[model samples]
Target: MENHNHTALISKLLTCVAACENCATECLKEEDVKMMAGCIALDRDCADICSQAARLLQRNSVIAHQYLLLCEEICRLCAAECSKHQHQHCQDCAKACMECAEACHAHHEPITQD
Candidate 1:
């Protein structure tokens, strides 16, 4: 990836991580927390993947591309789940997830084995 794309991808990944964290906290504050089981689950998963992807990308690891793909997949799933909720946090998270997924798709390339 070029320097510009790398920077953009990192920015998107950080946004995904921030969104996931906020979503999880918001879910915990829901009056009907049980109703947010799916959202909470996805939030946790997305957070983990986004965090890992960001770390790998920061290191410029070759495996970062693969992690980016995984992050995109997880973000998409999380976004779909969040879209079902009416909470403001969920809406914001869904938007962030969509943005992250787009960035990931835009920069993702197949990893080549050395």
Candidate 2:
């Protein structure tokens, strides 16, 4: 029985997952895909982390905040990689990653049980 209001976090996580996946695929399509091997790898890793984080949050895991922190790190890494590329896809992915990062940061705030 999860709170309906928290669905927004799930949605943002899903968006991050999709963006990272798409960025990896797009990187592979580039003419110099070999040069972006690291970026592609990071994108895949980020996507996986985002998915797992979302799953943990959806399940209301007590330690979900840790996963969200991981997701933020991965998204930042992916965004930095994508920002290095000049392709349109990379630009779009960077924007998405940035948004996801911000959302994760906002959602991970500590709740005081006063």
Candidate 3:
């Protein structure tokens, strides 16, 4: 990836992580938290994966491609799940997830295969 893309992707990844964290936190406080179990789980997973992916990206790791693949899938899933609800946090998270997924997918190509 070019320097610009790398920077943008990292920003998107961090946005995704923050969104996921916020979504999960809000989901836990929902009246029917049990109904959001899956969403919460996905949010946590997506956040963690995006965080790791961002760190790997910063280091220009060859294996970041794998992390991007995983992050894209999880972010998409989390977005879909979040979109199921009308909560503001979930909606925001959905947007962030979609953006992150797009960035990750766009830059899925492997770096130098060290």
Candidate with top lDDT is: 3
* Backbone clashes under 3 angstroms, per model: 0, 0, 0
Look at candidate 2 and give me any clashing residue pairs: none
C-alpha local distance difference test of each model: 0.87, 0.81, 0.91
TM-score computed on alpha carbons, candidate 1:
0.90
Per-residue lDDT of 1-114 in model 1, one digit per residue for the tens? 433337778888889889989999989999999999899999999988988888888878768887778888999999999999889999999999999999888767776676
TM-score order of candidates, best first?
1, 3, 2
Candidate 1 vs 3: which has more lDDT: 3
What lDDT would candidate 2 get against the real structure? 0.81
Better of 1 and 2 by TM-score: 1
* Tens-digit per-residue lDDT, 1-114, candidate 3: 333347888999999999999999999999999999999999999999999999998987767776788889999999999999999999999999999999899988644445
Model 2 lDDT per residue over 4-110, tens place: 36588888888878887888888888888799898889888988988888888877886677567778878898899889988887788888888888888877745
